[model samples]
Target: MQLLAQVLVNGVLLGGLYALMALGLALVWGVLNIVNLAHGALIMLGAYVGYYLFTLLDVDPFIALPIAMVVLFCVGYLLQAGILNLIARAAMFNTLLITFGIDVVLTQLAQMLFSADYRTINPGYAGANFMLFGITLPWVRVLAFAVALLLTLAMWLFLLHTRLGRGIRATAQNLGAARLYGVSPKRIYALTFGIGAALAGGAGDLYGVVSQINPYIGATLTAKSFAIAIIGGLESPLGVVVGGIFLGIVESLTALYIGPTFVDVASFGILVLVLIFRPNGLLGSTT
Candidate 1:
């Protein structure tokens, strides 16, 4: 019973961060209709940014998160406006090829600068933990989880309430009509990508606090993010949250029972099942 309880608690904590990691990908896919293969590369950039902030400026990883987000946001914005927009009206394959090219460039750049090093942000309180009814909760994971939930909620509110958010939604629904209403597709695309990159940056900051990172971790992170995004349903930002939490718990349980190596297999296997059976996603509307 104690072991089961601990596993559940750990799963939940991990799920929150997973949700954060997937939120950006889902938002961009849902709104901008662009499946950015370089999404994980952006997350990698965020980790490197946080790592350097800690090493050079002595800024806490948490405090450095916004800085990373802002920087990535600008990169994403420029990439969209200058490069991606050229192919905005092109086929999905064209967008995929462009993003894949971006991923290669980012990955090579990271390798050239940061080298292949496995680094983790070990804050003073990194190892600190507390007991809650026989379950141990690590402080870093708790903070990461809190930040994830807050970001998710903020994204939800922004989409439902803000004018820019409405413009984004309008463009997603009907690019032609959106243009009639004075929402430029190019501009909206840039803003959406910027927001997506910012979310990935924030997730990277949290991830660096808890996990080991290197220049190459982005590809795997991107795969996991996609799995969570699909499982959660791209219908709404809230769906990604649901998907992340569900995946977190599933992976945690699988690790404990089957073995750690099988976790990815289980995750992707379920993703396949979800895609085949419930194309809209578990929490997504069927309509």
Candidate 2:
């Protein structure tokens, strides 16, 4: 029973990070209609940014998160405005190809600059942990989970309450009508993409505190993000959160009961099951 409780705790913590990681991808796909194949590469960049800030400037990873987000936001904005904007009218296939190219370029650049070695942010409190009812909880994981939940809630509020948020949603629903209402589609698209990148950066910052990061991690992370996004559905932020937690718990149970090697199999298997049975997602409306 104690073992089961600990496993559940671990799964919940893992799910929080997964939700944050997939949030950016879901946002871009839902709002901008962009699949963003390079999303994981952007996440890798953010992780590096956080890692360096902590290593060189002695800034704590938590403190450096906003800085990474800002930097990635600028990068995302420029990418959309300069490159993607030119092909905005092109086919969805074209956008996918372009994003794939970007992902390749970013991966190569990361490998060249950061090398193939694994890196992690080792804060002073990294090794600390607390026990609750005989279940041990790592401080870093708890902090990361808290931050993830905070960001998710904050983003949900932003989308529902802010004027700009409504405009973005409007653009997503009806680009022509949005333009008719004086909302600049181009600017809105760039801003939405930038926001997505900012979310990815924030996730990366927290991810670095919890996991080993490397240039190659992007592809795998990207796949996981895609699965979570699909499983949760792009309809709402809450859907994505639910999906992430579900996947995390499933993976944890699989790892514990079956084997660590079966984690991906279980996760993707669930994704396949969900796609077959509920094409819209567990939280998504059937209509």
Shift in Å, residue 117, candidate 2: 0.8
Over 1-287, each residue of candidate 2 has an lDDT whose tens digit, in order, gives 88888998899999998998899999988877778899999899999999999999999999999999999999899999988887775777998999899999999999999999999999999999998888999999999999998999998899999999999899889988999989998898899889888988989888899999999888888888999999999999999999998989999999999999999999999999989988898999887
lDDT against the true structure, each candidate? 0.90, 0.91
Measured against the true structure, the TM-scores of the candidates, in listed sequence, are 0.98, 0.98
Write candidate 1's Cα lDDT for 19-126 as tens digits. 988988888888777889999999999988899999898999989989999998998899889998898867889989999999999999999999887899878899
Per-residue lDDT, model 1, residue 52, is 93
Show pairs that collide, candidate 2: none
Determine the C-alpha RMSD for candidate 1 after optimal superposition of all C-alphas.
0.9
Instruction: Show the lowest summed lDDT stretch of 10 residues, model 1.
Output: 26-35
Best by lDDT: 2
Runs in model 2 lying further than 4 Å from the true structure: none
